[model samples]
Target chain A: MKYKYWRRSRVIPFTLLLSNLVYVSFGLDPAASAPLVADTAFTKSAFYDQNEQCFRCHGNSKYTYFNPVSEKDVSATMCENRVIHRNEFYTANHRSFACVDCHAAEYDTFPHPGQLRMEAPYNCIDCHGYDEQYAQYHFEEIEEEFQQSTHYTANGDAFTCWKCHNPHTYRINIRNSTSMQQSIAYDNQICLNCHSDFERFQLLSDREEINLIQKHEWLPNQGLHFSQVRCIECHARLNDSLMVAHRIMPKDKSVKRCVECHSQNSLLMSSLYKFQAKESRSDAGFLNSIILNDAFVIGANRNIILNRISLIVFFASLGLMLMHLLLRMIFKRND
Target chain B: MTEKVYHYPLWIRLWHVFNALLCLVLIVTGISMQFSEPNRSLVPFDLAVSIHNSAAILLIINYLYFLIVNRLSGNRMHYKITEKGYVKMLITQFRYYTLGIFRGEKTPFPVSEVRKFNPLQQFAYIVILYWFFPLIIITGLGLFFPEMIITRIFGISGLFLTDLFHILSGFVVSMFMIVHIYFCTMGTRLTSLFKGMINGWVEIH
Candidate 1:
């Protein structure tokens, strides 16, 4: 029964591909020539029913395959994983956004325009174009930051924001401490999507493969560090902004030493630990504003009282001992 | 005329010289590291850390060697103050240092083959070897292994407290070194104890 189910499902996609190929060989439009074919999928409307309409085809658990990029076939499992989860959009930070805001403006038009391509519904730069005055708006400043990013520098035109954030499901400003950890892990997962997958990485870039474990062998509990801290914390250049910088450096240039994080003025405090506004002050009196936060750093969080008291006692004890020795020497000479 | 007696053993002399040099290196490097920053450091921070940790390891080995020698040669008994009249012995030693030494009065306890230290010297040595050294070493190990099980057991603040103890104990030891150097000069002839440390014999008046 399972074999029959698999055989039937496999034949449908191949048949569709053959028909498309036949039309393409004749130099005629494949789906455009036949209006009835595209009609079954999309219902014409003035407004978009984003949830049901988009997911109707995308959510299907079928073995539909396509080469989204050059010569590399993305499988059915990958497509379903990418698009099927509609519930995620509702919970996502971008929940209020309509599908058409990013997708084709009039995507519900009966037989979609001959000019429209299935791929690249909208480029990131299309919506997020630079605006000098309103630079603080979500898109403009991030676009500026992205331009400076190592990804953009390394891959030039090849890298896009979509490589890191899936527009359908990305979230932001996750402040709850417990969930913040998961949010950090989620963000890092996006980086690992390309980095951890050697095959996928090689398809896009010519850089050497990274062995994360070997790279971070000097650090103890490397897994814990990978999870707790974002990759950009060490990899990116530190900027005045609290967020991790976009300009990623090579591994050798990255801060891997133990003293970097465990010192009196740890850089982690400026980036990760600066969740609260008040904690950002570089000099807020005793022990600095960094250690005063809720977190306890091992070597960095020194007690001011203990340090001051110890110093006083150390000098007083030394002074008394010296005085006693001098007095005895003077008295001996007198006698 | 003064009588000469064999005091410091060959191993003791060697360990003493090595330990003195190691302690000097540790003190200098440790001070530089404490105030070190990227923009401002007495020595390069990495170099200071390397020297400090390496000297600490050597000091640990030298300390262990001294411990073994004390045990095998039964020199541990010299540092043991009897429970009875311990306070009186301290008082007498204190007076001898303050008044009696200047007046050329006889000491309550004199260095001998069996009794290597006076009561006050014995107490100070006991405190440094048994108490301070162990505290500093344990804290140093704690700094090295920040993520060890003890860190979890003691909570996050415990490690900072351990560092504080290490620093304080080191400060006390540095002060002890200053006093110890001066006392080393106080032997019957100024260089008598110094010569003894070098050649294993002290000329006692």
Candidate 2:
């Protein structure tokens, strides 16, 4: 029995060392990730040692979709001849590597618009550890902002940069996408995704509660264009210049009324003000009723007030110059 | 020697001088537009707009006048890209600017009624007259009438894209000015082109 115990003890130690060697050699199957659709042989080809190799097979499938663009066919067959979008690899240095390098997704060949079954955008951190070189990436903040945005807030994971941004072209070419045209017109989706829902702002109890009042320009739809009001109305600038009118001011509602100059719905502003309620699009749903191409005639219509003020200042400077000249003449003659 | 060296008409001289002057005004005003103000514009944005618009119209009209006057006078033959002369002319002028001018060497191509500009000058003038001028006018007009363009052409939705195109055109012009000013230093004398624009006569050494 003692002899048998000694033999077992010798075998256990040997097995432990052997198991340690297995773990070190393979790294818990980082290379052979099962359930993933891609052929691992491609990864074994040693081409994926750099990022550039990832593109060899993946880029082959890039333009394979049924493209209706008559002037430019974006089909995969054409991609071999056509130049890859420069902005796709706009980084200082880009890698052309195997498909499984970054996107470990299974490539579906049979489907019409061959879908890429890949990990989520946030999951990119797995292999791509916080790179010191790309420390200023700000990817997390952008991701968070996109999530908190009202457009996707509760339903965040439903989208990624690929939704609105085509990574291939990497251009926000507004020429395409008939559906996106309406959103661009109705609200600045780029900004709205981060800012508080303009529609959620309930009206203040009194006009005294509103701040940053200017001229009341009645937009179409009984002045219910919250999107227009929050952006263009208060933050108006001449010749597409940037300026601030609301919220940036000290938060004192008594300072200036929000609706004084944002007067699309000014007649209703009084009744709404008495209610002292917050602006909620859900409450009235009047935001959808905003009309287009309405004359922007609102308030006392003194949009050029800033322009006039500058004119006055210019004239004052001229007058001062003339006065100085006259004083110089008198002093010189006396001397 | 002062017997009007070649066939450059008085109208051509006047238009060229006027164009150069107005371009300077537009560029300066354009700088102020970009850097100066948000709402309180010191430069009367309206006046600037009017000045730019009028100047652009004059330029467009002058472009037509150039084509018409030159063709009518049968002077169009001077600017043509002839098979035998094109490459030879271009190389000769390039060599003059790079090496000959600095060495105090005489200009290879002398001015005459038929071939006023050296090949380099002809190429530069042709590009400026055709490509740069047309782009500026079209882009400038697009900016002034954003509503008309967005509504009539692509349905009010393409406003931002149109705006972007206008801004890009401005950027291209900005780049051209930087390069144009640098190259102007390579003139026979450092300020010869400047003097020529003002006086309508380039001194021939």
TM-scores, all candidates, are: 0.72, 0.37
Candidate 2, A115-186: lDDT as tens digits? 433324323222222444323434344444445443344345554444333333332211121232242343
Clashes per candidate (backbone, < 3 Å): 0, 30
Interface CA root-mean-square deviation for model 1: 4.2
Query: What's chain A's TM-score in each predicted model?
Result: 0.66, 0.28
Residue B59 displacement (Å), model 1: 2.6
Which residue pairs overlap in candidate 1's backbone? Answer: none
Segments in model 1 whose C-alpha atoms lie over 4 Å from true places: A1-92, A95-139, A166-193, A212-230, A250-266, A280-286, A292-303, B98-104, B149-155, B203-205
lDDT by candidate, in order shown: 0.64, 0.43
Per-residue lDDT tens digits for candidate 1, residues A210-313, read 88778677665466577657787788777665344566676667876555655677777666665543325554334644443333443455567666776787
True interface contacts retained by model 1: 0.09
Off by over 4 Å in 2: A1-232, A235-335, B1-4, B36-47, B83-85, B147-205
Model 2: DockQ score: 0.01
